[model samples]
Target: MTAVDFEGFVERLATVAGEAVMPFFRTMIGVEDKGGLGKFDPVTAADRAGESAMRQLIKSTFPGHGIVGEEFGSENESAEYVWVLDPIDGTRGFITGLPTWGTLIGLLKGGVPVYGTMSQPFTKERFFGDGGSARCRGPHGERKLRTRACARLEDATLSSTSPRLFSGGDLVAFEALEDRTRHTRFGGDCYAYCMLAAGQIDLVVEVGLKPYDIVALIPVIEGAGGVITDWEGGPAAAGGRVIAAGDRRIHAAAMDLLRSAGA
Candidate 1:
C-alpha cells in the first residue's frame, strides 16, 4: 500500500539474491561470456540463480507488479509498480572473486525509481534509500548515509567500473572527467554509487549500462544528496552513460566536461 511496505519487500528480495549468490563466491564457478570475442562480459550460475530466486519471491509477494531483470528479461512490463533487478551488479567482479559485486534491487513506481538497494552479502553490507533518505547496514551496524559537501570538481574523488569498459566517444568523455577530478579510481560498479552516497567518493562516471545496472542505484544516490544523470544532464532512470556526483556544482562541472568531450 505504501512505499515503506515496498521498501521492505526490496530488502527481502536483496536478501534472497545474496543467499543465492554467496554459494558461488570464490568457488571457481562456471562463467558464460555474455560479451563478444574481444570482450569479457561474464555471467555465471550465481547470477542466474540469484535472479531466479529473487524473481520467485517477487512474484509470490507482488504478483501484479511488473518485473525487469538482467537474466530472465521483462515480464508484465506495463504494470505500474515494477521491480527492477540486477542479481549481480558487478558480474565481472563476482566472477573474479572480488567482493565489490552486489545485488541490486530497485522499485519503480510508474516507471520512475522510488526506492533502491545494493547488497554485498559477502561483506554483509547493504545500502538503501527512498527518494528522501538513505541508509547503510552491515556486520558493524546501520547508519544514515549522506553525500559529503564537495563544491568543486578539483577537490573531488572519482570512480568508475573501469577505463577498459569505455570506448570511442564515451571513453573520450570519461577521460575528460578523470582529467578534471582530484583523483580517479577504477573498479566499483554499484559500489561506486553507494560510496558516493556514503560521501566517500564524490563522482561516478560510467558507460554502457542497462536499466537494471542503475535503477537500484538512483534512489540511494539521490537520497544521499547526490545526483544521477546521463552525460547530457538528463534523468538516468533508463540508464546508459551515467554520472553521479555528491554535489550539484560538481555534477554541473562534470556535465560541462562531458559536453565538451562530445563537442
Candidate 2:
C-alpha cells in the first residue's frame, strides 16, 4: 500500500472503531471475565463488537493484511501487513463510564508498527502517528503532536495502567521508576501513551502487555518525538515489558532503574 493510502486508512479505521464502541458506552452491557481462574478481568460487548467492526473493514478493504486482535485470535499473522487491535483498551474505565478508555488500532508492516492510533470514541478524540509524524483530531480540533522534553527522571511525570497490573519483582521494578519520578498517577491504559506523545505526561512504564495492547501505541509514541522500548533497551514489538518516555534521557534513567530491579 502507498503511504497516503495507509495513513488515510488509519483514520478511517479509528472512526469505524469509534462508531462500534459508542453503542455500549454507558448502557447495560454484558461483561465476561477473561482472567486467570476467578480473577476479574473484563470483556464487554463493546470490546467484541468494536473489534468485529474493525476486522470486517480490514477483511473487505485489505484482504491480504493480517489481523491480531485482543478479543479475537490472529488471522494470517505472517502477512506483510497486520492490523493489531484492542477494541476497548481500558475496559475498567469503559465499564465504569470513565473517558480514559480508548480503542487501539495499530498497523504493522513486516511485524513492526508503521502506523497506530488510539481512538477515545466517547470523547471523540483520535491520536495517531504514521511512522514519521503524529497528530490528534477531535472536539479540540486537529493539532500536531510532540513529546515533551524532560531530561531527568526526577523531573518527569509517570503513569501506568495500574500498579495492580504488575506483581512480584516486576512491581518492585516499576516502583523504582515511580519513586524517582516527580509525580505518579495510574489507570489510563492506551490513553496514557497518547498523553505522553502529546507532550502531556513524560514516562509510562507498563508490564505484561500483549502485542495487541502495545503494538498500536509504538508508532504513536515514537512518531511524536518519544521513545518506546523494552526495559532492556530492545524493540518493544512483542510487548511483554514496556517503557515509553517523551525524552530519551528520561528513558535511559527509567531503564536503569528497571534493569536494576530485575537484577
Candidate 3:
C-alpha cells in the first residue's frame, strides 16, 4: 500500500496512544529507571501503556507489519513494512509535568522512512509528514508546516535535548555550533524537532539517539524543507549523533564545525 494510505491509521494510533498516556500526566505516576548508576534514563507506566495500546492496534489491524518501540522490543522487525514508535518521546518532560513530550509514530517501507506523526495531546496539536510534504493541526488552527530560512549560523536559533547527552569530541562540536548560533535552548526532545519543522527553530543537534528516537522525525524535517543527517552528513534514519537544520546552508556550516571536532 502507498504511504498516504496509512495517514488515517497513523492518526488513530496517535489517538489511542494519547488516551493511554494522558491519564498519567501531572499525576503521581510510578517511574522506573531504565539506566543504571551514573545515568538517569527514566520510563513511566505511561510510556508502556501508550506503546502497548498502539502495538495492540497495529497487531490487530496489520498483523504482518513489524514494530520497533522504545518500551517494548521489536517484533517482526525485518518485515517489508515496519512501524517505529516512541510513545512518549519526552518521558523526562512528561514526568516533570512539562507538555513538551509527544507521541511519535513513524512508518517505514523497505527500511526507509515514508511517513511520520508527532502528536501532543496536552496541547491538542499534531504534526505530520510524508517526506515530500508536512502540516500541523492544533488549537491555533491547522496550517502547512515549513522551516524558516536562516542561511547563516549567526542568525540561527538552536536547540538540543540536553548537553548531558554529549561528551568528548561530540560535546566539543556541539558547543562550537551552539556558540555560533544566536541562541541555544535545551530540553526539547522531539518537540524541538517539531518546532524546527514548523519554522520556529533553525537547528537541532543531538547525540546518543536510538532509531525510535529519530525515525519519526526524518519525514517531518524533510517534508518541511529542512535537512537532517549525521554529523558526517549521512542519513539519520539509524540515529546516532545527528544534526538538523532549517536551511541547507546552515546544515553545511554545522557539519563543518562537527567535522573539525572529529565528531
Top TM-score prediction, candidate number: 3
RMSD of 3: 0.8
Estimate every model's Cα lDDT from 0 to 1: 0.90, 0.89, 0.94
Q: After superposition, how far is residue 259 of candidate 2 from its true place, in Å?
A: 1.0
Off by over 4 Å in 2: none
Q: Residue 223: error of model 1 in Å?
A: 0.7
Model 2 lDDT vs. the true structure? Answer: 0.89
Give one digit per residue, the lDDT tens place, for model 2 in 45-105.
Answer: 8898899989999999999999999998999999999999999999999888889988888
Residue-wise C-alpha lDDT for candidate 1, range 1-263, written one tens digit per residue:
57677767777888888888898999989888988988878989998999999999988988999999999999999999998999998888887788889999988888999999999999999998987999999999999999999888889999998898888877888887788789998898899899999999999988888999999999999999899999888989898888999999999999998888966
Q: Candidates sorted by lDDT, descending order?
A: 3, 1, 2
Task: Decide which is better by TM-score, 2 or 3.
Answer: 3
Off by over 4 Å in 1: none
* TM-scores of the models, in the order given: 0.97, 0.97, 0.98
Number of clashing pairs per prediction, in order: 0, 0, 0
